[model samples]
Target: MSTAADAPPALREPRLVPLHALAAGIDFGRYFRWRHERDGDPFLVRFPGFGSVVFTGTPEGARELFRAPAELLQPPLPNPIEPMVGPASLILSRGTKHRQDRALLAPAFHRSRISAYGNVIRTAARAELAGERTGAAWRPGTRIDARAAARAITLRVILAAVFGIEESRRRDEYTTATTEFLNSFGGALFLVPALRRNLYGLSGWQRFTAARDRFDELIDGEIRRRRAHGDNGTDILGLLLDTRYDDGSPITECDLREQLRTLLVAGHETTATALVWALYRLHRDPETLARLRAELDTAGPDPDPLDLVKLPNLDAVCQETLRLHPPVPIVLRRLTGDFELRGIRLRAGDTMGVALPLLHADPAVWPEPRRFRPERFLERRYGPFEFAPYGGGHRRCVGATLADYELRIVLATIIGTVRLRLSPRFARGRMPLTVPHNIATGPHAAITFDVLEP
Candidate 1:
């Protein structure tokens, strides 16, 4: 019940960055660096429409913000994401509801059971690679979009392992609807909140709504069918369908649909993007790629999938990829009450976030933070807050275990089998997320790779 008026004047932030710096084509790192250097840690950045936003990268501040009581602080998802996913999503849920939903959903993503899906991940990767264009089939200057290939593999895994939908027709319909729903993200309109309104039947919001409608209908039908027949398998969907509250009552349909969509969206796009960057970076650096293949070759022609994931160097590569280019660069939280962070007072409705990229680039924390050195991970382990590609604390990504398992397995499978090299001519925007060719941005990396041999 405390208000901003109770905060001492000594804790007020001393500087603010103009909102225009966040416009398209701006370098997010440079912008953060500019403000951080001038104002020090826990500085404020003002966006005209969004109001005062506190940005922090130091460990102390990050820990305070991330560990703050749920009643005092809450995750701040953008308006754009809410429309894309749904209002009742666990990602948007807060307080007791958030904790309950997380607990109910925890059984499905348990690490022990997820390892059983390694074959599913491997199978999906191999199938996608089998259909991919290889050196033997390439024309004069053909390059395969690694992002698309990665997306296909990850999407298939989600549909099978998570949804548990073995029916071909229903699966295909669901896939089509899901793809359309994801496509609705990005674009200039996504940033301009006012432009979200439907006008003359032409609007990003309208397109998103249509896609959501299609996806909702397909997923709802699948849910109803599963309910009538009962959950016969151990997929995430089946577990969710059977989840009950402490009162022994079943979860509502609306909550179930939102949770499924949350898993699908979070489970696919970010992991797929990280996969692309891993492949791209390895290919871009031939020595690293050679070393990785050598490590795989160490296990002979046919290594156990479990053994493949355990390879130290391969694990290092995935770790480095995530450290330098985390899919979700920022973890946002909004203050619900007056909060004191590193001697700075943040009022209710003020946004506070840990800028992952900047923290990863901190020299004091990571020596040569800009370099892509996989060995750093092998040398020493980073604390949860120090190397959190998947945001930390209670709200840490629910799919973290599954995602890491998939990334390592997928990388091991693809690199172990296919001979890959970076394409000579590279272009951006191939993927919806605009990760730079040299580094990661947002979720997707838009680099292409040539499949030298199968």
Candidate 2:
């Protein structure tokens, strides 16, 4: 074996040339596809001023990258998102700090705890879709913005499950604050530092900063109220508050608020986008929709939420939806020590981005990858790295179980209680926006539903 000094420098490795800023800014899924076709797997990516980054879309490479020790690899969170997720968010932290925070926060999302929230998710979904058509008949004067409705369901469910806030002035306050914060993130200014100056009255960054302040204030107030009343309820916030580090010290209020922000931002956005895609795909593919409904119907009236969660067809539909278009199609990591990845040397300072879409859509991994085939999931057992809508390894999404649970419950409730038809004008072939990270996988067309039965 060669010594470290004998190895070739990482700079000499093959690389994918940099794309212009304008090209890189739009449609990341398309960009990923183009890069995959051009450079194949483990291609180098470089952004001006951001330095060299490596992007990989192969299963073997992804597995090796994820399994690397934390001492050698670190999570690479972009600077632009730090203000949104906050400084102490787990996504932005690494090494011992990340492990400690993850440990203290893991119990809230434990399988048992997340399963218990199924009813809450169902109730939220039912309430959101109330008065919508149900049955096989087309009801006139019934149109629903699928994305907005999904957002409402997921936002409400997460608010209750994660924050333990029920319907109240405070809940409304949070909903409004979160909406404002999300709306302000649409502009390019958030990423382009030079152009971040105020424009057309209040700039995007200005609005985002202000929204963050309001959201933080509300979260802080809720934390304080819980502390004052000694309300250690079983919700995530309560669990975080009650948890103590191995040193037996409580999490700081600042850190707790940041964690809450991270959860709220990530927990709701991804689930909502997923629901949107699920609904859109179901309506477009009548055969798949019929199969799912048939599976759900076997459960009968007042079926156990847990049973609904386990329905094979329902599970397959959701899985296919995520696999075809994961809400966040890439996960970022930075090298902490010089390493050789699949025979390519990488320096400590390099960033690595895992291309989830390319990985999922690889024909070798999933035959006819572009086809929306839910049966694929039922027919095969994909390894963790093969079908990673939630990523893999230690840095995998902590909220994965909760999000999965919510998606199933909400989708089941919606399909069981509503007869949905795709809007005639629903444009096909439009690409999802890549600028705003949360809604990246959101459908390009405004998917309106005609509710026909109840």
Candidate 3:
């Protein structure tokens, strides 16, 4: 509750980047480089006239920043998602609200639930990858749109985890539409420039909200039908309904909707992105692929399909992919109040976002940051805060572990059954989120692969 004037800015962030470069792309590292590429300083720039500055070094500043004053340095969620995800989302909440939401939500994400969700992950992976046919006519250098393959299974896994839907019953067309709607809302980043004058005058949020609004009728209808049938809510919804706040109130329907929306957006898209990166890296580095294959083959068949989260190498591939191509390449934090550390000054109400793409790519922090080495994570020397596609601290991703489990299971199950290849020239999407060249982003040897019967 401290304002900028009361708390005072004390942290001295080195002037690493100019403010104007933020307009280019969501991930600045993809487009520009600062003077000292090793330090990766310029990549982690601050927006002028913001509540705080971005620190993209080792975990030192992140640790200091997120250490919980309970007042200043609020969670840095984009305002655009508020309408889509509802205020109940863990990502959008700050302070007491965050704590309350997290308490109610954490039970479903506990280790026990993670264990329970494993079978769901495996089944989803198999169901998606099982239908194809392999032929000797297929050449060795063939490639598939692994991103699409990854996204399909990931979507089903999350839905199964949250809604317990089976492959036969899954609504593919509806879900695909839903996914595109949420991802397209990222366009608001472009709208940030059009907001002139008034702070409350939200720019083009109506459009973003509309994208998410398309789902409300469907979601609300489901909730209403479940309530009407006197059906026991079974998925994550069942868990949320069973929880109570410290104030002794059962969560309202609105809250459940927000959390579900949050899970849909964060849970699926992120894992899909990483899986695409994982498959991309695996195809590019055959040694990594072979070793990963050996790990899956050696682990034997896991009964609970979701058991892929435990393989150290499988875990390593996910870790390495996340290190290289994070779904969330930026970490945004708004100042709750004035605060400072590392000789840097921060004021309340200022917004700061870390270029995670650059930090993960930092050579000083990660040796040969560009190399696809899963073993680097095996060292276990790196802190969770140090290497995150997921954000850090109390605001860290609510589904981080589950996302990991989902990614690893998909990687193991698919690779265990079949190999993939694609045409090199068919490479899709020029930027971070790989789109298919034809139906989906694909085809450079890195982006595509052939699915082979192992």
Candidate 4:
């Protein structure tokens, strides 16, 4: 077992590249070989123009590095996100504050609590499908707004999970506003932080980036409403308001808002994208699609969401999807102190990025790495960090179980009842932003389905 006594001495590796010229447009993954070829040092890439150190190693290395997550601070977040996503975000905070913030948020997603959200999740899913059936949303002549479909379903689940009874009243209102706000960003904001100022300012792409002042107004209002009551309610906001430490100090409003905001953005976007991608995949492989449908048929009418954990095929599919298109594919960990990584010495404040998309596709670890096969995940278990789509160690995602729960329930609901397929053209060259680009892209999953009753 690794202990604190371990000293971070200088390390040299078989392949170490020094920071150099060929780092721009780096593929990110396969950086091990690339880095070795370039002399095994850190380098920069130009898509958004950032620096990174690549780590390709065992579970042991991963465990040690992440053991003290606080020690691994990351470079400053790209612009716009820094302010737009909120400064105190669990994803942005450092050291003890990071640990404390994550601690406050963890209980809401603990195993038992996550399981409780399943039934409600299923209910919300059915509502999405109900709307899809009445119109030719994705039929030959009509095109459904897929992201909108995903946003609608996920937002409801989040509201119910976070607000409980409050969801019954304001779900529709929050759905329109929140989805509109998030959908406004899509692929644009992430790829270009500089454009953020242009996009959010007055008359700029409807100029939401400058609308922070307005966002705070709404968020603060929600917090106040939740606090008026207490944790005796079911919403996570309620629980957060009521939660306290042994010292009897409750979390601050700023911290609470950041956590909630993080959940709001990440919680929906990540899961929704994954599921849409999975559906797109299902539409591509008839054999896999047939098998998935067969499995769901066996689950009977109104299947129990928790029961999905036992379905190996379903589990494998989800695993493969995550591996291929992990919602947050790139991880940024700053070397807070001079330390050794995979036998390479690093300086403090230097950042190492784990390109999970590349890692999952690396032929070294995944045989037939490019092929989409869920069985690889079932063949054996990998360490938590080794197979992390939700990250690893102490800073692992608090909502992992909830995310899995939501993905399975929503997927089972649709796959069990609907018949859908993908369009012919968009299937080719559809780049996966998330890892594990499935057989279909989310936008191409514009295919329609006819719901069948069990």
Highest-scoring model, lDDT: 2
Q: Write the per-residue lDDT of candidate 3 for residues 1-454, one digit (tens) a residue.
A: 1223433233323343233334323334444334225344322333432323345445665566556375665655445345456667788777888888888888778877787777777777766655422222223444555655666677777777776666543456447556656654543333242432334536444544555677766667666776677664768866766678998898778877878777876678678777877776777777888888887877776534554577788888888888777665556677766665444555666555555656676666888887889999888667765776777777778788788777877778778877675445433434243221211112223455665544
List candidate 1 segments past 4 Å from native.
1-21, 132-142, 166-168, 427-445
What is the clash count for each candidate, in the order shown? 0, 4, 44, 13
Greater lDDT among 1 and 3 belongs to 1
Model 3 C-alpha RMSD to native: 5.6
RMSD of each: 4.0, 4.2, 5.6, 6.1
- C-alpha local distance difference test of each model: 0.73, 0.77, 0.62, 0.61
Encode model 2's per-residue lDDT on 1-454: one tens digit a residue: 1122432354233334334445556666777787677766676655543445667788887888788887876766455567678768988788898899999888888898888988888888876766322322224557888877777778888899877777657666788898888777763653465545567656776777788899999899889888999987888888888889999999998899999988888889889889988888888788999998888888997787888988999999999999987887777777778876766776676677678878898788899998899999999989987888987778898989998999999999888887877677763554345444443445654568787755
Using all chains and alpha carbons, the TM-scores for the candidates as numbered come to 0.89, 0.91, 0.81, 0.81
Question: Candidate 1, residues 1-454: lDDT per residue as tens digits?
Answer: 1223433354343333234434322455566667677767766655433444667787777788778887876766554357666767877788788888999988888888888888888888877766632323332244667877787788888988777765657666776887778777554444455667787778777887788888888878878888788754678888877778888888898988888887887788788888988887786677888889889889888666777778999999999999877877767777788887787766787677887877787788889887888989889998877888988888898889889989999999888877766766542323233432211245333467666645
Evaluated against the true structure, the overall lDDT of model 3 is 0.62
Query: Where is model 2 more than 4 Å wrong at Cα?
Result: 1-19, 131-140, 197-201, 427-441
lDDT of each residue in 304-396, candidate 4, tens digit only: 788965677788888888887676655556666776666656667555555565556556577887677877877987666577888776667
Worst 10 residues of 4 by lDDT: 432-441
Candidate 2 or 1, higher TM-score: 2
